[model samples]
Target: MQITNEHNEKMAKMTFSSVYPHYVAKVESKGRTKEELHQVIAWLTGFDDQKVKELIDEKATFDTFFKKAELNPNAELITGVICGYRIEEIDNPLTRKVRYLDKLVDELAKGRKMEKILRKA
Candidate 1:
C-alpha cells in the first residue's frame, strides 16, 4: 500500500484492537512478547493496518516484522511512531486484553474508536 502522510495519520489513529490479532498470533507462535511484536510491526510497516495484516497473514518466521518492510513502505512510518518508547510503555496488558475481547466482535460491528484502556485508576 501507499505510504502518504494521510496514511500515516490513519495508522497512528488505528485502535490497538483492530491491529492486535496479527501481533497476537505472532507473539503466541514465535515466543515474542507483545512489545517485541509491536516493535517488529513498527519497524516493518509503519503501522498501516492492511500491510501489517498482510505481513502477519504471510506467517513469516522471523522474530520481528523487519524482514520484508520493503514490500510495504507504509510500515516505515510505523517505525517513527515507536521511536523512543520502551516496550513496557506500549505492551500494556490491560489495554491489550481489552483489544483481545474486541477481536471477538464481527468486523461490521467492531468499534474502531481508540479508548484509553490504560486509564490511571
Candidate 2:
C-alpha cells in the first residue's frame, strides 16, 4: 500500500496520550500488564518509564514523541505486516517508525514473548 503524506501528517498530529488508552486496552484485554506495554514502547523508543509518563502528561504528538526518542539500535529488526503495510517495505521513514510501534503493540496483544518482542539478543 502506498503511504501518502496526508496519512503521515494525520498520524503525526495524533496525540500519544489520546492513542495510549487504545493500546492499553488492546493488551490488557488479552491479560497483559501496562508495564509490559511500557516495556515494549521503551524498547522501541528508548524512553524510560518517567519519560514515557512525561510525554503522556504533556499530550505530545507522534512527531514530538518520536522526535525526543532515542530509537533502539535493533529497531530495523522489526519487520512484517502492520495495518496491511509491510514494515520493511514502507518508504517513508517516519511512517515506518510509527507503524513499527503499532506492530509491536499488536504483537504484544497477540501474546508474543517479551524477549522476542523486544528483539533481545
Candidate 3:
C-alpha cells in the first residue's frame, strides 16, 4: 500500500496515550493481560512500565514518544503486514515505528507466543 505524506502526518501527530487503551482492549479481549502488552511494548521501545504510564499521562504524540524511545535493536526484526501496509516497506520512520508497535500488539491479540512477539532468536 502506498503511504501518503498525509498519512504520515496523521500518524505522527497521534498520541501514544490515545492508542494505549485500544492496545489494552485488543489484547485483553484476546485473553492477553495488560502486562503482556506492556512487555511487548518494552521489548520494542525499551520503556519500562512506569515510563509507559508516564508517557500516557503526558499524552505524548507518536513523534515525541518515538523520539524519547530507545528502540530495541531487535525492532528491525519485526516485519510483515499491519494496517494494510508492510512494516518493512514503510518509508517514514515515525510511521514505521508506529506500525511496528501495532504489529506487535496485533500479534499479542492473536495469541502469538510472547517470545515470538518479542522477536526472540
lDDT of candidate model 1 versus the reference: 0.37
Clashes of each: 4, 0, 0
Candidate numbers, best lDDT first, in rank order? 3, 2, 1
Residue pairs that clash (backbone atoms under 3 angstroms), model 3: none
- After TM-score superposition, the amount by which residue 101's alpha carbon in candidate 1 deviates from its true location, in angstroms, is 21
Which segments of candidate 1 are over 4 A away from where they belong? 33-121
| lDDT for each residue of candidate 1 in 1-121, tens digit (9 for 90 to 100) | 2234553444344554445676466445554455544444443335555666665576542323333444233211221122233222334333222222233221112222222111112
Superposed Cα deviation of residue 69, candidate 1 (Å):
25
Give the distance in Å from residue 36's predicted Cα in candidate 3 to where it truly belongs.
0.4
Per residue, candidate 3 scores C-alpha lDDT tens digits across 1-121 of 8999999999999999999999999999999999999899898889999999999999999999999999999898989999899999999999999999999999999999998898786
TM-score of 3: 0.98
* Candidate lDDT (C-alpha), each: 0.37, 0.92, 0.94
Clash count, predicted structure 3: 0
Q: How far is 70's C-alpha from truth in model 1 (Å)?
A: 29
Give the alpha carbon lDDT tens digit for every residue of 1-121 in model 2: 8888899899889999999999999999999999999999999899988998999999999999999988989999999999999899988777888899999999999999999999887
**Global fold similarity of model 2 (TM-score):** 0.96
